[model samples]
Target: MRFLIDFFPILLFVAAYKLQDIYTATAVLMAATVLQTGIIYGIDRKLQTMQKVTLVLVLVFGVLTLVLQDERFIKWKPTVLYASMGIVLGAALWGWKKNFLQILLGSQLTLPTAVWGRLTVIWVGYFLFMAAINGYVAAYYSTEDWVNFKLWGYIFPVVFIIGQGLYIARYIKDDSNGAEKS
Candidate 1:
């Protein structure tokens, strides 16, 4: 259920692209994202920072794409988003000596400080890698190819998330028996 909600917009965007064109797909994506955000807010009673940022970016870029009739705006949206996240995370970790990831998830996961730092670094690297790859594809590929890549490129995030979960699993303390699980 959560997975479906998270991917609702992207799935709709791909379907719309297949059925129509990039502009139509952009519009569909914008609407689907707005709906997705609303659904998330309804379920959680609030919106996360990332969710808000994603909604704003989708609407802004989608509008630009439609108004200008240029696919580049929509295509580059992911790059911009990924790059911004990477930069913010990296800066928060190194410059400010703060780990945003830990700040956000520390209440839920009781990992060591060192583990949190490492996780933040890993996230920063992942975000930068995604941004670079998306930028490359969006700049060098045709719109159709970019759309196809968008559909298939989901594998990256899936793999990253699985890997992250596995990495963090060892550090997650088990409270069932009041003993460390790992």
Candidate 2:
């Protein structure tokens, strides 16, 4: 349910693009994001930071794409978002000596400090890689291609998550004993 709600904007954007054009798609995306955020807030009574960021960026860039009659702004939004995430994660791990992934999810998933550090590095690298991929596709590809890339690009995250889950499965503790199996 929540996944569909969150993805409503992207789905709408793609549909609008197919039906009309980029400017129309941008407007639909902007409106859909606003509505999604509002609906989430009404249901949950709170908004995640990323939800807010998505709303703001969609509005800002979507409007730019509509008002200026250029699709570049909307195309660049994902790259900017991915780069910001990478910078923040890298700074927290390297500069502050903090494993943010552990800080955020430590209670749910217990692991050695080394594993947490490695997970952090993996996340940072993934974000950087995604940012580069988005930038490259947006800069060099046609609008149709970029839209197609956005749809297909979801696979990268799915693969990353599955791969990470597999990697961490070996580290999970034995449920009966509450001790990690060696």
Candidate 3:
């Protein structure tokens, strides 16, 4: 459910492109994103920080898509968002509040500080690379190619990152039982 909630905008954007005209799709996506954010806040009884960022970005990029009548802006939205996250994570890894990534992901797993810093740096580099690729594809490649790359390019890196995280999690032995056995 949380995953679906987080993915609501991306799924909506893809569906909007498939179901109707681009402008109409943009409108539908904006509505769906707002509704999804609202639903999350309603259920949790508190607003999430990411909800605000997602809502603002969706609205801005959706409008950019409609007003400029170019899908390129919409395509670049994720790149911008990811790059922003990368910057913040990179700063955190540099010792400016090391808890940043942990706060975002700690519910799922715990890791040593070195692992967290390494993961953060990897994410930072991934975001930087993704931004450059997005710019190149949007500028030089065909629209169809850009869209295809946008969809497919994201999958492999995400899968690889998750796999690496899982491997790290496995090596993070449980400490709770040590005291009991001692």
Show where candidate 2 strays beyond 4 Å: 174-182
Angstrom error of the Cα, residue 150, model 2: value is 0.8
**In candidate 1, what are the lDDT values of residues 1-182, reduced to their tens digit?**
98899887888899999999898999999999999999999999999889999999999999999999989999999999999999999999999998999898888899999999999999999999999999999999998899889989999999999999999999987688676554
Error of 2 at 63 (Å): 2.0
Question: What TM-score does model 2 achieve against the real structure?
Answer: 0.87
Candidate number of the best lDDT: 1
Writing each residue's lDDT as its tens digit, candidate 3 over 86-106 gives 777787767576757677877
What is the Cα-based lDDT of residue 152 in candidate 2?
A: 75
TM-score of 1: 0.96
On a 0 to 100 scale, what is the lDDT of residue 179 in model 2? Answer: 56
For TM-score, the strongest prediction is 1
TM-score result, candidate 3:
0.76
Tell me the TM-score of each prediction against the true structure: 0.96, 0.87, 0.76
Deviation (Å) of 26 in candidate 1? 0.3
Comparing 1 with 2 on lDDT, the higher-scoring candidate is 1
